[model samples]
Target chain A: MRVALFASCLVDLFRPNAGFATVSLLENAGCIVDVPPEQTCCGQPAYNNGDKDNARDIAKQVINEFSDYEYIIVPSSSCAGMMIKHYPQLFEDNAEWYKKATDFSAHCYDLVTFLHDILKITSVPVTYQGNITYHDSCSSLRETRVKDKTRHLLACNEKINLLELGNPEACCGFGGTFCVKYPEISESMVNDKIADIEATGADTVVSGDMGCLLNIAGRLKRLNKPIKVFHIAEVLAGMTGIAAIGDADDTKKSEPSS
Target chain B: MKSKSHAFKQQAADALVNVSLQKALLNAKDGFIVKRKKAMDELPEFERLRTKAIEIKEHTLSHLDQYLEYFEQQVIKSGGTVHWASTTTQAQQIIVELCKQANARTVTKGKSMVGEEAAINDALEAAGFEAIETDLGEYIIQLANEPPSHIIAPAIHKSKQEIADLFKDHHKKYNFNSKLETIPEIVNEAREVLREKFINADVGITGANFLVAETGSTLIVTNEGNGDLTATLPKTHIVISSIEKVVPTLEDTSVLLRLLARSATGQEITSYTTFFNGPKRNSDIDGPENFHVVLLDNGRSNMLQNENHEMLKCIHCGACLNHCPVYSAIGGHAYGWVYPGPMGSVLTPIMQGLDEAKDLPFASTFCGRCEEVCPLSIPLPKLLRQHRNHIHHDKLNTSRSRLGLALWAFVASRPALYRPLSNSFIRALGWLGKKSGRFSWLPFASAWTQSKDLPAPAAQSFMSAWTQQQAKKKSSENE
Candidate 1:
């Protein structure tokens, strides 16, 4: 199966390891993974900011670029949600584009859902040792319905112990531009999320979306907490040996296993 | 009500550091969510009921004119009067005139968001009628001289101590001055004070939860039975309600009732679900001598004809508000309007003008929990986005933010331009913060850096690395 990876803009710029892990996971599942160079963003920023024209243009670009692939997978549920749920609505008035958007959306899936539901991959060969908690990105939990698929995949690794956050479903408040627009409210929400993370006493917190990971990791760093944050793809791909998000480059250096 | 929504940012900031308000919010948030979940879990047909309720509301809203007319005709047949008000001022004038006609010196009110929207208490007070709130929560906030932070639970933002203080400060004149220590004590004191007002009041007013057109009856659901007293005790009963509250029949109302209490307070039903038809006929036993329904339009007609027609379907159960993270963080007062939370964010801008409530729509993280938990299946996030689109079109958003979005959209839409631009930007940041892997402060991102550190970019963009890796693989396969 030829799958085009929509390495969401956050994963593209902030943390490529997640993108690499997604590629590795997909490749290991016996799929031919194609990184579509034309993909820049899933247009969530523009869409969420209410810039419909730009969002529509960006959506068209994404639909045109990845339409040929058998499947289009995004590591972040937010971006996948943009494609699977929102893209059709973006082109609702234009029948031609609407048909194209819906058809394209049909084949699009978030990485975990793609792995768990479509590929029927019960487990990966990678293993990690840690008491970790999972944060449910709002888009993952509500948009793409990625509640148990992630946990099911994580349970495959006997070495990993998953402790649940008190309220895993609450948003971490990255909200694309909302953090910048309403920093005070965003700070309060993320603080609540961090308190929940801390209550579990998990040394590591993992999530599927990089936007949320970055937000949670950034706050944890600012507070100078010892908790580490990693994208679910990195943990599942056994790439946790690299420095965790928001950590110093040399902090978690480990011998390369490959 | 005069809008303080334009100052939403400042109000939200104030709400954040308000120790008492924060305590109140923390205590209130989880209970509603948990109770509603439990109630939903207990009912196997809740989802089916929600869908039926949506259909009923949608049908009624589509034919709102007919149902409202039918309701008015039925009320007139039952010897009652109906008044139409296009705006809040008009609604206030109509109510005040009714009070004057009834020779009302004192007025009692049941909990009504529509009443709040019209500022009816303020209007009544200005007109020399001593307006008293009968609902326990409303009475608490009335004494404190504040607008309700939550629709159903008017004093949800007030801690018990705050309520005790408000009562102590105001209740001394009623000969009940001891600081109320327990919940029952507070309720009993409020009931004692309000009992006198409810009996002495010449006119009683309540807001309708739903207007049954088939019977021309206005319905109110309350736990305290304040609505019943506010409707039946006084000689004249006035119902201030929005036009969208009308449903085709009592059967339709029943479908919505099932969802309402469960969604609002997670009860199978409110303690009192009273329906008031019209004035007391000679055959009637105990009821108001005169009945009047004031149908307030207040921008709802415009809403019915526009993109916001779906909002009129809201039963005001406040399930969206309960589930909203932003509402949980800042509380309703910060939204600076009568209605608050996801529903308020959408309604405030439309009713008060986008310029006044511009920030309300943008306040959400679009977590989608509001829409997820909404009983009527109101797509609250989508409605908020529509408001955002209107703001963006009207250039209501700050020019700096607008420019930022425009710049981002420009580069993000074109991959060829975006790839190198992002590559260089990330590489520069990566090199600058190579040692720390994060930035404690950045020049333009003060909003984010103020509260949290910004994580550094990866050394190479994913596309850049992927291209190189693909080329290496191609060369290796060929060799």
Candidate 2:
């Protein structure tokens, strides 16, 4: 299978390891993974900001870049959701683009659902020894319905103990541009999320989306907490030897032995 | 009813720092979410019922004029008067006139958002008639002289201590001077105070959950049973509702009622779900002497013809508010309107001019949870996005953000330009923050750095590194 990876703009800039990990996992699943260099963003920021003309143009660009692939996979649920659920809506009035958009959306999947539901990979040959909790990004939990599929994969690793957050379904308030636009309320929300993560006593927290991971990890570091954050793809691909998100580069220097 | 929606940003900031309000919101958050889940989980037909309710509302709204006329005719047949008001001022005038004609001195009101929208209490008080709130939450906020912080739980922002203080201060006039300590004590005091007002009141006012066009009956579902008392105990009963509340039949109303309680409070049915057909009939023993239905348009007629027609399907259950993370964080008062949360964000802009409530639409994260939990599936986020589109088109949003988006979009749509531009910026930031892996503050990102540290970018962009890797792979293959 030929898979085009839409390593979201956040993953591309803020955390490249997650994108590389996603590529490794897809290759291991007997899929030829291609990272289309022309891709920049999924246009969520423009779309959610209500810049429809720009959003529409960006959507057309994204469609043109990845439409030829058998499957288009995104590591972040919100970006994938924008493509699969909202892209078609953006082109609804234009008959030709609407048809192309819908066809493009049908082939899109967020990474975890692609792996669990499509690839049917029950477990990965990876081991991580830690008490870890999961944060469900609002898009992942509600939009793509990515709950048990992620846990089902994570649970297959006997070395991983998944201690769930008190409210796993709650958003971490890294809502694309929401964190900056409404900084105070966003602070209170992410503070509540941090408290929930702390209550679990998990040394590490993992999530599928980079926006949430960045938000949670940034707050954790600011407060001088010892908790580590990783994208699920990084952990599942057995790439944990690299430094965790928002951690000093020297924190972990060894390579994965397996 | 006077919009503080314009001050939503400042109000939201203030709400965040309010210690007691935060506690109140935290305590109230999990109950609604958990209960609604359990209720839906137990009922296998809940999803099906939601679809049916939506269908019913769509049908009714499509023929709203015909159904409303039919409803009016049925009310006249039942010996009731139907008054139509196109604006809030007109609605207030109509209600005040009815009170004057009835020689009303004091009026008892059930929990009514329409009454809030019309500012009926202030209008009545200005007209020299005392209006008493009979619902416990409504009564508490009334005593505190504050707008309801929540629609269903009007005093949800108030802690028990605050309610006790209010009761202690206000109930002194009734010769009940003891400070209420327990939940029962607080509830019992409200019941006791309202009981006297219900009997002595010359006029009663309530909002309808649904208006059945076939029967001309007004339906109100309340856990407190106060709506029943407010609609029946007085000599005159006046139902304050919007035109969109009308449905074709009792069966359609029943479909909505099933979804309402479960979504609003997680009850299979409210403690009281009463229907009022009209005034007392000749064969009836006891009921209101006069019945009047004050159906207000209040921008809903415009809504019916526009993109916001789906919002009129809302039963005022407030399920969306209960599940909203923003509402949970700041509570409803921060939204600064009669309605709050996702629904209010959509409605306030349309009802109270777009410029007045511009920030309300942008206040949300567009998290999509509100639409997920809405029994009617109102697509709240889409409606909010529509408001943003309007704001953008009308240039109502801040020029700085608009310029920022335009600049970003220009580059983002051009991948060839965006790739290298983003690559260099990421590398520069990555080099700067290599030690800490984060920044406490940045030059242009103060809003983000204000509350939390901003995570630093990786040393190289993923696409840049991927290109390097691909070149290496191709060279090795050639070798």
Candidate 3:
């Protein structure tokens, strides 16, 4: 199968390893992956902020680039959500673009859901130690209904201990531009999320969206918590050799050997 | 009721640090959420009922004018006066004139979000009439000179201790000096003080949960029997409600009542579900002598013509507020208006001007939980986004962010510059933060790094790596 990896703008800049891990996971599942060079963004930030003109332009660009692939897999849920759920909304008035947007949305998928449901990959060939808790990103959980897919995949990995955190469905408040617009509210929400994560005593926090991972990991780092954060793709590909998000390499190398 | 939505950032910041308000909010949050969940769990047909409720509201709203006309005819047939107010000030003026004609010295009120929206108490007081709140929550906030925070639980932001203090401070005028430390004591004090007001008030005003056209009755759902007393014990009973509250039939009202209590306070039904049809008949012994219904449009008609017509489907259950994460985090006071939470965030900007309450639409994270929990299934996030669209298209947002979005959009739409530009920026960010793996501070991003570290970008952008991979693959294929 020819799969075009929609490495979202965040993954393109902040965390390319997630994109690479996604590719590794897809290839291991016996699927050919294509990273389309012309891809930019899914136009979520603009679409959400009500900039329909730019959002539609960005959508046209994305639709032009990825329409050739059999599947367009996004690494983050929010970006995938924007493509699958909102692109059609962007072109609700125009007939020609509306059909194109709807047709393209059906071919889009979040990375984890694509691997678990579409590819029928039950387990990853990689493993890591210590307790891991998952933060359900709001877009994936509500928009895409990506609840059991992550847990189902994680449950199959014998080497990883999956612990569920309290209120896992609660948002971590990394709402694209929301975090910056209302930092205090975002801070309060992430603090509550960190407390929930701390209560579980999970040594590592795993999430599907880099925006959420960055928000949670940043808070954890700020509070000086020992918990590490990683994308599910990174852990699934056993790419734990690199330092966890928001942590120095020395913190990983000179660990307390738990 | 004056809009302070623009100061939402400051108000939310204060609400987060308010220990007392946070404690009060935390204590009440679980009761509403958990009980609603349990009630829905017990009833197998909750989701189906929600669908029916949505249908009822939509059908009623689509034919709202016809139903409202029918409702007015029924009210006049039942010997009740129907007054139409196109604006909130008109509603207030009509009510004040009615009170003046009745020679009302003291007015008793049941908890009414509509009354709050009209600023009725202030208007009545300024007109030289004593307006007393009969509902316990309304009474507490009235004594404190505050607006109702939550629609159902008016004083949900007040702690028990705060209530005790408020009662001690305000109930002294009634010559009731008892230690009110517990919830029951505080409630008892309020009831004791309000009992006389209910009996002696010449005018009683209440808000309608649903206005039934078939029976020409206004339905109010309350835990306490304050609404019944406020309506029955006065010589003149005035019901102030928005035009959207009208329903086609009593059966439709019943369908809504089933979901209203369950959604608002998690009850199978409220303690009192009374329907006041009209003034007392000749044979009636103890009831109000005159009945008046003031239907306030107050921007609702404008909503009907806009993209936000669906918001008129709200039943004012407060379910959205309880289930909303943003509402739970900041509580209702931060919204700084008569209505707060998800519903308020959508309605305030529309009711008030888009420019007046500009920040309200942006206050949410668009979690969609409000829509999920709404009994009417009102697409709240969609309405909020509509407001955001208005704000954006009208250029109501800051020019800096507008320029930033413009620049970002320009770069994103062009891959040639975007690829190389983002690649170099990411490499620079990575190099700068290689030691800490995060940036404690960065230019133009202080708002982000103020409370949380900004994660550094990866050393290699995906596009560059993909380009290198393609080059290597082509070379290998050539060989």
Candidate 4:
């Protein structure tokens, strides 16, 4: 299968590894991935921030870039969900563009969902022996319904225990650009998210969106916790030995014995 | 002065940390949401009506001016006085003048959000007239000296225990209440109390759900039939509603009405979809002697010219509030406005100002639940994002966010600049963070680090890694 990668703006700049992990998983599943150099943002920030003019231009750029691809796969569920779910409505009045936007949405997939549900490639053909907990991103859980697909693929890891965090689908306070805009409230929400993770008794926290993982992991780092974080794609890509971040590297990472 | 869209973090934190308020809100939030959902689920045609409802609202908004004129003529033709209120103060002035004209001492009200928007109750009381809210929910909120938190259930933030306490404390003032027990008992007590006020009321004030332009008829749906009593028996009947509530015909009104009840309280249809065309007919046995319709424009016409014209299509179902995670967590008080939830987030900024209500839009998780469930199908999140974009241009955003945007925009605008910039940034953070495999508390990102650790970035970006793998494959094939 020929797929185009819409590596979200966050993954392209803040955390590139998630973008790479997504590519690795897709390629190993026998799909040829194409990274369009002409790509830009999906205008979610512009749209979310209420700038229709700029959002329109940015959305047009996305449509023009990937309109020809048979299928588009994205690393982050939030960004992908925006295009698939919201793009058609963005161009509602313009018949030609609206049709094109809807057509594009019909073919886009979030990485984990694409791998487990769409491609049906369960195993990474590699093993990882560790206990893990999954942190469900709000948009992915609510919009794309990524939890089941993410869990199905994770279950293929015979030696891993995927313990669920309390309020698994709660927002981690990294609501796109929400963290910086309302830092105080963001802290409270992430604090609650971290508390839930701590209660889970799992040393590693896995999530689909790098934006959420980064925000939660940032807070945990400040608190000096022993918990670790990784993108679901990296784990599903047979790349578990290289802990993404927050794990004690040389000091021996310990999973919860229970 | 909650901004149209503020950051969810600040708002949620402020709401959660308010111990007494949070405890009060927890029960009320669950009660309304669960009840409304159960009501909505019982009707299979509920979803079908949502689409038709949107169609009717859209139709009304597009021809609002024409319909408003038509409605006014109909009301006047039907022997009812039609008054246009350009502002809230103007609307209150007209209503008070009507009260004085009739020499009215007591007024009974039936759940009007437009009244809250107008601040009408204060004006009536200032004029030495008593205005009693007949709705149980509104009565509770009136006693609490708080704004109605939710649209349908006005005092939805109050618990049964808090309510019992409130009545116990205040019941003696009204000369009642030996004992009040159970939800049903409290409900009965309120019914008994309000029933007396209904008969004695010289004038009745109620907000109409929709006004039929062709007939100049006022339509209000209530389960308890308080609206009927409020509109009848009294010598004067006055309706305070925004100009946007006019529909061209009764058929059009019916279409919207079907969805309004289902989405709001999950009822198939409110028990009383009462329509009052004018004052008592020649042979009518029981009807008001005087009928008045107050058409309030106040910022609605301005919204018509703006991009939010679609928002006027809202039937005021309050479904958005019940489904919103942000609203569920904080309740309506934190919104600091009359309107709350997804609709409030969009409307507050426009009615207030973009600068003042900047945090309102940021309150949502952008979960799309509001958009999905709205009877009018308003693109609430899209409108909210527009508010934020406006804030960005005015430089109203905080220094941290503006800085974050500038930094991201600079590198992200170009791949060549972005690639190397990302490489060093990721590697440096990833390397430094590897001790315990993560660094606690990153400087400059203290707000984020305060709650969670930054996941160390991978040593490499996806682009370079993919390219490297391809090169290795080529070399292996060549060898």
- All candidates: TM-score of chain A: 0.96, 0.96, 0.95, 0.91
| Tens digits of lDDT, candidate 3, B1-479 | 67887788889999999999988888986789899988888879988888888899889888999999999999999899999999999998999999999999999999889999999998999999999998888898888988888999998888888889888887788898888888887777787888889889999999999999988999898889999999999999999999999989988888899999898888999988899989999998888999999999999998888788998999999999998888888998888888999999988887778888888888888878888889988989888888888889999999988998999999999998899888888888888887888888999799999999987776778778767777988999999
lDDT of model 4 at position B433: 62
- Tens digits of per-residue lDDT, candidate 1, B200-257, equal 9899999999999999999999999998998999999999999999999989999999
Q: What lDDT tens digits, residue by residue, belong to model 2 across residues A1-258?
A: 889999999999888888888998898899999888789899988888888999999999999999899799999998989999999999989999999999999999999999998999977866577899999888988789889888998987878899988887778888878889998888888899999999999999999999999888888888989899999998888788777888887854422221
Q: What lDDT is obtained when candidate 1 is compared to the true structure? A: 0.91
By DockQ thresholds, what CAPRI class is model 2?
medium
Looking at model 2, the pairs that clash are none
Where does model 4 exceed 4 Å of error?
A9-20, A34-47, A50-71, A82-108, A112-138, A141-172, A187-207, A215-230, A250-258, B1-13, B31-40, B176-196, B464-479
- Judged by DockQ cut-offs, the docking class of candidate 1 is medium
Query: Each model's fnat?
Result: 0.89, 0.79, 0.77, 0.53
Best by DockQ: 1
RMSD versus native structure for model 2 = 1.7
Q: Candidate 1: list runs displaced more than 4 Å.
A: A251-258
**Candidate 3 DockQ vs. native:** 0.67
True lDDT of residue A62, candidate 1: 91
Instruction: TM-score for candidate 3, please give it.
Output: 0.97
lDDT of 4: 0.77
Candidate 2 per-residue lDDT over residues B166-222, each given as its tens digit: 999999999998878999999998889899999899999999989999999999999
- The share of true interface contacts that also appear in candidate 3 amounts to 0.77
